[model samples]
Target: MDWSQVNWQPQIGDPHFMGWVTVLVYLGCAILAFKLSLNATHCFKQHIQKQRTFWGVVAFITLLLAINKQLDLQSLLTEIARTLAKEQDWYDKRRKLQRIFVIAVAFTGSTTALLLALYYRKIIMINALALLGICFVIAFVVIRAASFHHMDHLLNQYIAGVRLNWAFELIGLALISANAIRRLNKNTRHRASVD
Candidate 1:
């Protein structure tokens, strides 16, 4: 229980092939979302400000997720909590604590999403696909955070030699990218029509 004896080095949660692929996908999605946000900024169209806010949030979230994908910062959080539980003589009650933590995370995430959707209702209708993608990403994070043994095992399993986690994460990134490309194209066409 000595804090000095504990290893404080940073660890790579997923250093294998599929992990890097997931990171790349996250970066790609972030770039696309950032581009979409910039497009909104340079436009004079209706709801431009709303679109900017939505895409800006998406870009920022994806960028942070990209960094987290490789760094596995969440593991550090888990480790800290574990240490605290042991020090407090409540390590045996960690299961209950973890359950409560996961439920709280789920509730907070769901409430935040609902509030955002309501606040950006018009933009949500326009970028519903990206919103869906965001939900998928959020769900993946929550599930991962839960760190349930069976769920973790399932996510770690190989699907046609590709990690299942990669599939789940990439699917969400693909949706966001697809929406960004679609909106950018639509904007281009709109400018053409205007000219």
Candidate 2:
């Protein structure tokens, strides 16, 4: 199998299925974001800038996972073989570790999203969601750091323009969480003053 000679089409391998899932999940997140932050701001029309920003961050993380599915080891090997003028993976020891990470994150994300739906007006839920994100990122980074050689030198190499996107997403999540905390504090102060 000549990887160099192989054609890398947009519909390559499992990306087709995973890409669709990503799109659907992102769209769902966007809708929920609008609803969650609808009353966030003092504006009249209900502009959830905070929620919008948060969802964008969520979309970025989910995007990374979704993209990882198709661009993983087995699929990339085929692409590499096609482009490199030969095939590889003789030992069948493809790193393919991204699949595990994706499964973990997806399960956490989906489960939390469903739980959020149940607690639409609860500030505690937002705090819990932020904690969940923190745990997942920390666990993943620790695990990956420990098992660095499993995948290629850099993770998410197969996807274009998604490099370090998860980092940015984490930063965004932190910022929004801070804002939510501030808002919670201010509301508490106002209630205290009234009492």
Top of the candidates by TM-score: 1
Query: How well does each candidate superpose onto the true structure, as a TM-score?
Result: 0.89, 0.31
Candidate 1 deviant stretches above 4 angstroms:
1-8, 41-46
Give the poorly placed runs of model 2, Cα more than 4 Å off. 1-101, 119-173
Candidate 2, residue 15: the lDDT equals: 38
Model 2, range 1-195, lDDT digits (tens) per residue? Answer: 443465554553333544454445434433333333433442222434544454445445545543543454334544563344334433243334445545665687667666655543334344456445534553444344334354424544544555443443344345434544554455457557758
Candidate 1 per-residue C-alpha lDDT over 1-195 given as tens digits, one digit per residue, 9 for 90 to 100:
667534445767679887888888888888888888887733446779889888999999999988988888766666676777788899898878778987888898889889988998867776888988988897897778666778899998997987888889888888988988888888888777878
Clash totals, every prediction: 0, 15
